[model samples]
Target: MSDPLVIAVDSSTSATKAVVVDKSGQVLSTGKADIDLLTPGMDMYEHDPVQWWESTETAISQACAALSDADRQRIKALCITHQRESFALVDEDGGALRPAILWLDSRAGDEIKEYGSDHIHELSGKPADTTPALYKIAWLKKHEPEVLTSAHKLVDVHAYLAHHLVGRWVSAVGSADTLNLLDIANVDYSDELLDIAGVTREQMAELAQSASIIDTIKKELTDSWGIPGDVVLVAGVGDGQAAGLGTSAIDEDVAYVNIG
Candidate 1:
């Protein structure tokens, strides 16, 4: 007779939050973990990739600790949403290659000038702004070419977390759209964009639709967190997309703004 429960995780720039919600749309529990934002130089922001994963696990654990045994058992899914336009590189083993470049990084100013064009803008729904991940990735090719070639996967936060959670290097299409690498109209990767970023489609996570199952949580995480091994891991949209969903502004005509 108990309401079904769902755990939602939001991994943003400064912090990660985990909220447990029931079928009736009320939040049953909430938890958060702070992350350090590194500003190595002017307009360059970075986050330790390891810290992202660690903070996510800690936040989810904190959230679940607030739930009762019965409530935890009733949980049906783990859903994740995150900041848009942030990205990192991972090895074949899912080990992080380096700190993640933040969406605001201006290190690729020159590359932006070169790659910025009407064709690219039309190909990707996003404009050629510093906010997109590709410009900074191009900067990596010019300055640290080895890093780009050495990387096994050019992933967003969702792909990294999904790998850890479900053993799949796949991400929600909606979340991957933030990378500026996908053809938003087609909801898939753009070959031209990949060439500009110095990566191949093989180096990206397999795409899954938002709200679908990427995979199930692995036994290791389930055991460590005291969650069921069979718990489903659902693909989640970008934070902006989630906001629209949360606000009941499902129509494109309706604008949802976050004052924060």
Candidate 2:
């Protein structure tokens, strides 16, 4: 019998990575790609979504290439952990609508204030800030109206990668919650927020649980990358949530803090 395999993809603010692990959580292979976050001005940081996609692809391909055919055949699932809130818009054809505004982009400070920070905190359990997609969307609409008008979907980083991997757009509940467009208590996008952001429901990806299987690896990609075509792609959670689970900090009363 073969050892069961799992692939983990971590897409964070500074880089993207992939790791192949056995059932025992021992890593067999790992790959990483650095991404440059561009700050063109004060309160504005951006990245090319196309570059992000390429980085993710490079990481996955490199990881898979390091495995033998027998090792690849044992792969059971591919799970992702990603940065939250940072997003890019795409047209019907999946092409980027514009450069993605990162989580640290504060160009939407006025929009966050307009949405009323107290009200946002009450609804989403977090204050309105540059870290939420709502503010970024507002920034795009105000300053890049052309791009906003062209966009058919508003997608976070994970959803974008999932779409490229499985050939379908999917959003995770935990990730969606970080968007500030979702009612955290209800775990769905808020109509009130749509009204506030002037976006329609159709603009968002369908939501699924963080652990749900979204799709299998598409044959072309699998063949090209020497990975099993039947590998399951699981819906990804936000990085913080995945870290909590990996570190066994899911229990209440425990808080994980990052100093840097």
Candidate 3:
């Protein structure tokens, strides 16, 4: 039997990249697709949420195209590492209600100042910074009340992509943690935080632990990729956490820095 293979994806702010790797972690093929950044106003950055899934599909298809039939059949799983704190509100069928808000968007500065405090920092383990999705969601609640109240779900990049991959709404704990809606100690969503964002638990994705197998990729996706066997989907973390893991920076004494 051939060695098992996995597809690893990094859906960053600028692009989506995919790599096919064997059990030994040797990358056999790779591909990439760019995402257009949308700026509608000062300090407002966004992306068409549809582009997220479309780019992912394109990148993965390109990567898997380089593999042989046997190699494709050997593929057993898929995992995603994505930009943290970016999010979108979607309807029940996963259609984006609007463009996804990017992490770098600073439009929520006012909300941050109003809501940032020791209590929030203690609950989220994230400083009172512009990066978390919490403040931006609050901004929406204040200014775009109709958009927030009518949306069926609010999801991070991981949950959005996972829905396209597996036909389910789920996100890894580490991935969702960057949203500042999680209770850091419990590694789960907090009611207090959700209430502050004007969303409910029903609006969140079902959480899964990082690195665990979540579910098999949709049959249509595998068929389109020319992969004959079931390819399980693995829960993933935010790109920052993935970077640490990629660099072997797990130990307390080690630190990883990205100059870029």
TM-score of every model versus the real structure: 0.96, 0.95, 0.98
**lDDT of model 3, residue 8:** 97
Q: Candidate 1's residue-wise lDDT over 141-241, tens digit each?
A: 88889989999998898988898888888889999988889887888999989999999999999999998877778778766766653679999988888
Please name the candidate that would achieve the greatest lDDT relative to the true structure. 3
**Comparing candidate 1 with candidate 2, which one achieves the higher TM-score?**
1
| lDDT values for all models | 0.87, 0.82, 0.94
Global local distance difference test of model 3: 0.94
Model 2 agreement with the true structure over 114-141: per-residue lDDT tens digits: 7756877888777866688787787667
Worst 10 residues of 3 by lDDT: 1-10
Answer with 1 or 3, whichever has the higher TM-score: 3
lDDT of 3 by residue, 112-170 (tens): 89999999999999888889999999999999989998898999999999999988899
| Model 3 TM-score relative to the real fold | 0.98
Pairing residues by index, what is the TM-score of model 1?
Answer: 0.96
lDDT score, residue 124, model 1?
88
